[model samples]
Target: MLVRELLKNFQELANKEVEFTGRIRSNRQGKNVSFLVLNDGSVIDDVQVVYKNETKNFEQLSKQRLGAVVYIQGKLVPTPNRPQPFEIQAKISEIISECAEEYPLQKKEQSLEFLREIPQLRPRTKTFQAVFKIRSLLSFAIHKFFNEKDFVYVNTPIITENDAEGAGEAFVVTTRNDGKYEDDFFGKKANLTVSGQLNAEAYAQSLNSVYTFGPTFRAENSNTSRHAAEFWMIEPEVALNSLKENIDLIEELIKSVLSYVLENGRKELEACQNFFDDKLISRLESAKDSKFKVLDYAEAINILKEAVKKNKNEFEEKNIKFGLDLGSEHEKYLCEKHFGSPVFLINYPKEIKAFYMKLNDDKKTVAAVDLLVPGIGELVGGSQREDNFDKLILRSKELGINFDDLSWYFNLRKFGYYKSSGFGLGFERLVMYVTGATNIRDVISFPRTPNNLLF
Candidate 1:
């Protein structure tokens, strides 16, 4: 039986015979008695097994090393006054596989940085086990949220000829030893997709509401804690939705997922709280319960400028102006210090945003929005797409984007295309925010960063 099931039904299964097969997390033994903490990875907590010298292979069981796989036939005994609710009194015990003495994960506490070196075995640790379990639950909650809202899930292509973001950060896809493009596999230049928004938009025109949850690649050489070379994105496109409606949907989705994790992942959250961040649960609750503050880009710039005026060294980038792009420091200050909750900054300058965003009436700013949370700076980014073909072409030309490459995307505007809105949420960043994991590498199973690609 799994530790989660055994613990959940301990009240009814007390004093009943049960069999458990799992890895040994900790082994404490005396001459007569041996205690083994076993974990099967179903949950963060482990089951404790107490065995006396009467059991078979008693000497081997007593000397069993950590990380050894063991099977135990035992009876659950209730311990009301102890920290754990119940303990297993082992009647029969055997080592399924003995661990080598060179196991790296000793009983001593290790740093998160040190654990990153062994991605293959770090999941056995309680910290990563909790983080990954919460990640899995959050992923399921995302699908549930969109499915209940009648959004059709679309699997976008991994390789495409067009760059959706036009940021020139796409990883090139080629199967040629020589540097010839025309003789390549696709017959033309192809690259791994950076965002699935363009493809999801094409489906939204027909399905009304569609979402794409898949892996996207970026070729940037960033080694920050928040950036990763390969990551998963959750992009959802809705037809006929304005910027305001898009922001509302983002808010609803965030709150719904937060509530789901808070309710369903209580044990994992408790484990995270005890180890990583103490304010993890309360911070998530605050975000779910509070109404997200909506501040205009102009007003936010002014707020930053006023703060800068009060203190010269308020921000590292010192220049808080109208058209300047908001950095991580600026974003964190706005949400963490100014609002103390999630803040949605809207109507950014057209120069800083993508060419696909809808131009507002002022013609200087686009109808774009960025949702900034407390610890993590920007959690979600979205905007209302420009519906006019002429304006889109003009914007593309102004940004030096090739018109021939995206001719099919341009034709969407000509063929019964109306206003649509969508956003891209970085799955790793969301996991980091929810799990209180400081680094993006901690949340991902095998993170693909600039210089790290260990399995």
Candidate 2:
């Protein structure tokens, strides 16, 4: 019986003979009796088994190592005053796989760095067991939210010639037969996609609403806690949508998924809270209940400048001006310190934004917004796309992006271009925020960073 199932039907299974198989999490040998905790990865909590010296093979089973896998036949007995509500009285025990004495994950706390060295085995730890379970639930929650709203899930291409962000942070896709990439697989200079927005936009124009949830690659060399070479992105595009509508969609999606994880993933959440962050659940509850703030970029800049002058914070980059692109520290100050909740910083200067963002009436700034949260700085980045073909061509030229490479994308605007917008949310960052895991590496099962790719 699975631990989760046993817990759900404990009243029915009480005083009944049962059988189960699981790995031993802990073992203790006493003079008259012994205790063994078994975990089958069905849930966060393990099952407790008790056996005395008279039970079959009790001597060998009681001396099993921490990671030993076993099969057991037992009777469920209620323990009203014990830590666990019910305990298993063993009748027969079978060793499925005997563990060596060198198991790394013992009944002791281990540092995150030390566990990271053994990524393959880290899932057996309580911390990652909770983290990965929450991560999986969060992914399912995102798909459920989009599907319920009648959005078509589109799978975008992995390799492309166009860089949607236009920052040139792409991992070049190549097949080097003679020490150079002269023979490209796609017969062009191809690179992994930075965003799926451009492709999702074409589909959204026809389908009304569409979203792409897949892996995105970036070749940036920065080794920050938030930066990863390969990550998953969630991009949602909708035709005939305004910037305000886009913001509303984002807020709804965030709140919906957060509520789902908090309500349904109580076991995982409690485990994470007890181990990682004591206030993790309360923080998530606050985010779900509180109303997100909206502030203009100009006012945000002014507030940041005033904060610097008033000695509110010794900002690393103290010169917070109008045209300056805000960093993590500035975003944290606005969302965490200033507004004390999630805030949408809107209408940034065109020079600091992408070329596809719609140019404002002033022609100086563009229609862009970034969602900033308390613990995590930027959770989502979105904008209203430029629908005018002539303006788009001019903007691309102004940014020095080759027109030939993006001519295919421009064709969509040429035929029937309507106002459309979308946003990209980093999947790993979302996992980090929900799990209260401080480092990005802790959230992902296998992290890809600069000069680091382990199998």
lDDT of each: 0.93, 0.90
Give per-residue CA lDDT, model 2, range 1-455, as digits (tens): 78888888888999999888989999998788789999888888888999887778887897799889999889999998988889899989988999998889988898999998889988987779999999999999999999999999999999988999899899887786553544667767888999999999999989999999999999999888898888999999999999999999999999999999998899899988987789899989999998899999999999998999998455999988889999999998999888888999999999999999999999999999999987789989999999999999999999999988988898888898889989999999898889888788899888998878876
TM-score, prediction 1: 0.98
Clashes of 2: 0
Please, what are the lDDT tens digits per residue for candidate 1 over residues 163-244? 8888899988999978687899999889999999999999999999999999999999999889998999999999999999
Error of 2 at 39 (Å): 0.7
Residue 71 CA displacement from its true place in model 2, Å: 1.0
Residue 3 error, candidate 2, Å: 1.6
Worst 10 residues of 2 by lDDT: 176-185
What TM-score does candidate 2 get on C-alpha atoms?
0.97
**Highest TM-score against the true fold, candidate:** 1
Candidate 2 whole-model C-alpha lDDT, 0 to 1:
0.90
